[model samples]
Target: MDVVVIGQIARDLAVRVDEVPGPGAAVAVRERIEVLGGKGANQAVALAQLGCRPALVGVVGDDRHADEVLARAVADGIDTRAVVRCPGTRTGLIIDVVDGGGRWRYLQDLPEAVLLTAADVAAAAPAFTTADAVVVQLQQPLPAVCAAADRGRRAGATVVLDGAPPDPGARSDLLARCDVLRADDSEAGLWADAEIGSALDALRVARELRARGPRMVVLGAGSEGNVVVWPDGEAVIPLGDADVVDTTGGGDAFTAGIVAALHEGPEAAARYGSAAAVLTVSHTGGRPNLSREEVAHRARP
Candidate 1:
């Protein structure tokens, strides 16, 4: 399972409080966690935990935080040889503030220089060439995302796209090259140009997205869970029975799970994804902890 992940990498600081403060009032911080995180980093970490050899492709700064996060990526069993460190730029940072009821707020320090350029994606061509799957985060510049996807498709690898293309004009091109498309509620709404108010609505949008190009489509339907559609079947998938502790990292874990189990049918993949998301949201911050046996038992497909 050789995979290439193209997206953001950042230093994460997670603070947990029973409740958010208002005005200038102060409250006690129940816990603080600092780790390697970001959409790309979290997905790669989840893949590694699921026994895939993942190579991270994203930009960072030549700062101490970059070094620390890179070391952490290596320790988590991810290949960091393709990570770019831009000179004179500050490493990206994300502050995740989670409340007692599994809600989270984020403060991000991601700058333009920390984002990948098309040239950066081109430079990591070797990784794409050898990948069995290439997972792309669409929040990056369209040029970079297209470049990575094109490289993967040309190399005969499964190209999985995460999130909707921020550029409406670029959707067709990106979808045409993608094998799978996965998006959360807001992102799914972005694709549909309206809120997905129900599972049936999500299913309709998923089918439309699949018609555009993705062989499989997974769209979030708020609390109703995820809607999955493929060539031969479709279903409204629900989350596992794990109590939600913090919703952070759940989407990334879901994407990783699907990518990891996509060798099975799409239904099995959706169940695995749902199970992984359940496990991730049960903890804080955007890092994943997964177990195959646990996921298999928890999945409902």
Candidate 2:
């Protein structure tokens, strides 16, 4: 993959339970399903589906699940050489609960998931150096992610940052290093200090964020579509409606699609990205990422 992704790779244990649990209340549920997940892994898969070979850098436990993860990555055509095997830890796993209304909730206990060390980051630098773009998510330690982004920039690659799993304390220096910034509407509010209530508001918020560092900012509004704000101006990327299945990974798919479309042009990038995201929300988990042909078909006028 020409895109290098740095962050967490984990397994998700999802269940359909009753309403959200209160302080000390117990809720009963139905069934549970375990799937390979983690935002970084999801984005890498999404990027691969878009015809970009993605290289993922992260630490996974030397367990069966870890082996499966590595195998899956290779099978999906993602580079697996940079994945570190932490000898004693188990693979990171998240507990996700969905209610009758399809409201999703998460509880993460990443015992086996460890942030990449400086040495680990150094080992993966070469991959970023040769890639067209290095993609980053907040699943890894801030310092590690910063280092990777810096390395990618030094290597003359576009540093795309997706600042989700929102952190209130992210450093401005790192923000300054980003070239393309993507975030959800709520995250746009946290960065711009404005309520991104509508698509126009979200575009404004993205423009505001551009002043801080990134040359371009994209605000993902889920079913509302997306907005791209740059130094020149802003435009809303339209999307066709679909029966939403799972909201998870829609934004990641969007990020992946945009990165893939970077090889084309901005307009194509935005349209393909919107299509990928809309299609993602129509499926289950983060798998079944839309291929370039699928994205192209959806993006057609």
Candidate 3:
């Protein structure tokens, strides 16, 4: 009940292939599956599964997938009362391909996802205003993310931004509103205009982003784990060894972990958050549906 997620929601079609296509060469597929995805939805599901109550604010079309998405959100313990049903426009969609090595490529169609108007934001104002923290992603328009962050901050909630797709031209106002800024290595590298080849490089980028305003910067270092940088000091929480399945939602899970930890305190959250992410990699799909007890059991021992 303390966390609010605002942004686009889409259904993901994930396919696992034996090899990737190289310059006009097509490859054979080993297997395929579809699931609900999108950073907003994924993170919301992650929060709920991690034992944090999360409410989602977004727009979905009047389609079967939309129905399924909403139903799934409810089943996942996410509040969908703020979700809108836009007519005519199709529910957002994503086609993701994962190679044998876990490399991924995705093509998304998000027309209806952009339908979260200012009115939609107004409807969710109460949730944002009352929550302890607000979670947002870049899948939606920059303006919406900004407005949501501003509203949440004004309401006395900690605003957390998951800067995905690595938008370097991100709005400064939005950056200033964020309490925690989370992104992967590639995104960090893009923002810093330098390659994040190592933890030190990631730390440098985190520092650069922190200069913009966020109280904390978390650079997701893939298998190398994550680096949490603050004004006082920096902490590197290495990923525990886990078998790789699909890496799509691992970062979202990590974000959920960080938020949950923040619900406690920074130091406690970092260790638990690190465990949540590592456990996610050990599971399949984008969002791992594990309870807090399960996460703690795996994370601690």
Candidate 4:
């Protein structure tokens, strides 16, 4: 499938620590690595790895980091022709601190990414219109995200929104434009007006999010699996056990899987997403070790 991913592109600096330090305490870093990451880029790469041949539409700086990010995307087989180069700005950057438990905390510098404007979205109209699906992350400016979603919908493509808007008030309009909406526990809580730590909470969040406007809603609760709600019905798809090494891009990987299997029903697509996420978390970086064949094999009952 030809999918278009719109959002942030950044270089990720990752550090491994035994534990996260307290406010005043310092901790030893066990290891450090840098890789291509950002919600948008990660999902695009995941789609490419899954044999979707995705096109990326987002902004980056004129800096060398931008070159690295774009190079990696192209190497992974993503079409980067729609990636904008903004002068006088640095590419987005993210620092991920992973603890022994495989959980992570992120610090982001996204000045350039958030600067993506309606003009940028307008420039990518060809990509949006021709794509079978368009996946948008909330990392970009609200206007740009909305514009891209609107364009994709008008083009008769399936629009999948990857996260909720930072402002709760603007979420309804965004949801209404998207065919599918996927969110992690925290984002689900923001939209559902309830905490999302447990399975029940995830289901409630999915139901509430569905009520907002999306034709389908997917709420992912790490380890608890995913709750999928669509027009027909809802289902809780459980994921298999994984040896998690990092959790940084698991959500994005899940999003890619969903887009790849969208022709299937919501429950089946969520199962494919869960399988993709299991492979991602088992690796150290945002990139997954498995290919489309491997993911399909794992998804099989």
Question: Best-fitting candidate, measured by TM-score?
Answer: 1
RMSD vs true structure, all candidates = 0.9, 2.8, 2.7, 2.2
Q: How far is candidate 4 from the true structure (C-alpha RMSD, Å)?
A: 2.2
TM-score for candidate 3: 0.88
**Model 4, total clashes:** 0
The lDDT for every candidate, in the order shown, is: 0.92, 0.78, 0.78, 0.85
Better of 2 and 4 by lDDT: 4
lDDT-best of 3 and 4: 4
Winner on lDDT (1 vs 2): 1
Q: Global CA lDDT of candidate 1, please?
A: 0.92
TM-score of each: 0.98, 0.89, 0.88, 0.92
lDDT at 50 for candidate 4?
82
Model 3 is weakest, by summed lDDT over 10 consecutive residues, at 163-172
Residue 244, model 1: Cα distance from true site in angstroms = 1.1
Q: Give candidate 1's TM-score.
A: 0.98
Measured by lDDT, the strongest candidate is 1
Residue 95, model 1: Cα distance from true site in angstroms: 0.3
Give the C-alpha miss distance for residue 125 in model 4, angstroms.
Answer: 1.1
- Shift in Å, residue 58, candidate 2: 0.9
- Can you write out model 1's per-residue Cα lDDT over 149-239, one digit (the tens) per residue? 9999999999999998869888888889999999998899988888998899999999999998999999999889998999999998986
